[model samples]
Target: MNEQPPGRRLGRGLAALIGDVNSPTPEPANQLAPDRTVPIELVSPNPRNPRRGFDEADLIDLAQSIQKHGVVQPVVVRPSPDQSGRYEIVAGERRWRAAQRAGLAELPVIVRDVDNRTALELAIIENVQRADLNPVEEARGYQQLIDEHGYSQADLGQVIGKSRSHVANTLRLLKLPDVVHDMLVSGTLSAGHARTLVTADNPAEVARRIAEDGLSVRQAEALAQTPAAERPSISRSAPAAKDADVLLLEKKLSDAIGMRVTIALKGNVGELKLVCRSLEPLDELCRRLGQG
Candidate 1:
């Protein structure tokens, strides 16, 4: 007997379940047209899906919540092509399943008249911006954007308010061995730890150390940082300011820019220098300082 891989199986099942991944979107009625509002029936959701388990008891509780508070967020949906009037959920599976469990017949949904490209992009942006989406969901969303929507990391970065390198780095995290990914997704590991592990030939070993050692982000960065064959000793620091005003100004600048600012006093003249971790941070600091 042959068995389909999990990814392949998931894809096949989803394909068979809905005409389009975004088909669950509901269409709004046009006042100009006589024909408006299509009929959609409640259907049993597939249990095998990796999404979530919607409890009936929980649903009753949610129904009470909805009855009291109403639907704060709109459910996402896609139109039905096989049936005359039906829609499937691209996202918000839990809400739909809960609404059904709550004994609600119809859900207020936005029917996005969008193709695959628009659908995946919007879904990714919404999930990423909301900050509710977990790393795995985010990774999946990014993968969908690239595979289905023809988006590069640069495109995704712009869409999600992240730098292109950020997107690329995050995607690379997905390539870590499944064990490492499991640790990442389960919160046993951090993005920084995973990033450092990328340099290791055996990431599993690094992941094991991360789990057992409980490495801090700084510690992980230290391990990841290049080790010099002959380490140089850092010189002792001395305050450059001769007077209180100059020291106060350096501290003030540091606080305002959220970085370390140093004033080196040599005789009558003092050199002001700002140190930052990255270009974006430096640029942002410069912009604020320039404004002041």
Candidate 2:
């Protein structure tokens, strides 16, 4: 009796959509047969690849690895639409670039016949799964799929293995100023810090404070709520004014729990008010506090 081939029955999902050839060692049952190998001169990077920037340091590291180990995983490619006898990368562009840096002459690739939509989806999925996209690039990729392909937020969540709320929140990052987006892309700001700034009245100012003061995400949340005029004054000549650290602490609690939090202290006897925006955030806050 003959045994069935591996990956031949991967029913109707991403693995089937793109060729199941991501593994370092291609199993005879799962690997793309014919084992297409293209010269480095014939392959071009996909213009629509969702990833915008590659860190030079990282590329050097990858190039060094490729030099030592050779490319273990084959890149996914399709015939170039514009040029004859040329291939466009559908996934693994980074590896391809590193191969060039390592002075490689050819690369192994899985040639898949795919249209524009499939190509875009494969690129996005591959980058996201590998955690290669920055927040801005990730949001832009999500927006492209939604706008061009008509994917709903819930549908996108399912595609990317995230929650609907998480998708919604990530989409909100696009509303921030270009500077803030740049900060996120360059790793000057954390995703948590960037998310809290989305709803801020003045995101640029908040971003500046975050970079300058090295404020924690929780502290940034408090800074967003405390009006600009009131913040610096907390340390000034107001004898009756509340302590600055106390205000920051209150804001941290509010941000951490996703609610409106206030603390009023009278000689160490204080009242705490945690205001919930809705039932869901409230439940989340309660759940988080319980975990704490």
Candidate 3:
């Protein structure tokens, strides 16, 4: 049994609500009066954990720290719905894994009686707050919440303490193709580069160039904005020109929204086009235009 004083109730603050394992001042997510310390074997990792990849070197370092000085904070878990006498980890998976690597028999835990929704929310919040999830993982988590729980961008932003626009932009990374996704997950492409390539004519080809040339985000955006036929290929000529004033306006708009903007004018009766690769960017553009 976990050691604790009688009637030592935990609070429902964000630290507790989010299951911050590394919280300097730990607290509980609810009014649950008691906390328990369970055997490490009984505590299974959450399969739905938003954080997918863990750096092996960092894990080793964490294990060494645990070996020197045991787990400072307790992991948060919930009763497993599928198995009796088993618990599912809601947060602090890294700590638990490190403890196991450090050869620990048991560790402290706070077993909350939260439902599936709360469990997923807590896991996402914990990973996001700690900056543990990578760009792909972060976007996937947001998408999962939106898809599985019917969470709107505004609702997710409110819950995660972010602006809806920020949440929307982060979620846009998922529109990247498989090649770009691998590049992003492996750190070959930055979030900025990935976002710029979303609407490109050939994202995989452009992503290859970006990686081969070590192009910056701005450079990638410039390359993506260029017409495919006039992209300086060995077989292609230069691109057609627009009016100088129209070009200037397009540049301004593109810079403002971090995406491509185009204007076509025949006699002040032409169209203004804002090109967005995904719903997130479209939402961002709409928000900027005060239309969202």
Write model 2 residue lDDT over 138-231, tens digit each, in one string.
8999898889877788777766667899889889999999999989998999888998887788998889888777787778888877777776
In candidate 3, which residue ranges exceed 4 Å CA deviation?
A: 1-14, 18-34, 232-292
Candidate 1 lDDT tens digits, 1-292: 5755323433443333222333222123311121122222532222222233234554665566556554433455566434455665544555565565556656666554444434444445544654435565577667766776467787667556679888888887777788887787777887878888777666786577656766676565555453533222333345343578877988998898767898878778779897653223454565565667
TM-score for candidate 2:
0.72
What lDDT does each candidate get?
A: 0.56, 0.76, 0.75
TM-scores of all predicted structures: 0.55, 0.72, 0.70
Candidates 1 and 2 compared by TM-score, better number: 2
Better of 1 and 3 by TM-score: 3
Give the C-alpha lDDT of model 1.
0.56
**TM-score leader:** 2
Task: Tell me how far candidate 1 lies from the true structure as C-alpha RMSD in angstroms.
Answer: 13.4
Assess the local accuracy of residue 109 in candidate 2 as a C-alpha lDDT between 0 and 100.
86
Question: Who wins the lDDT comparison?
Answer: 2
2 or 3, which is superior by TM-score? 2
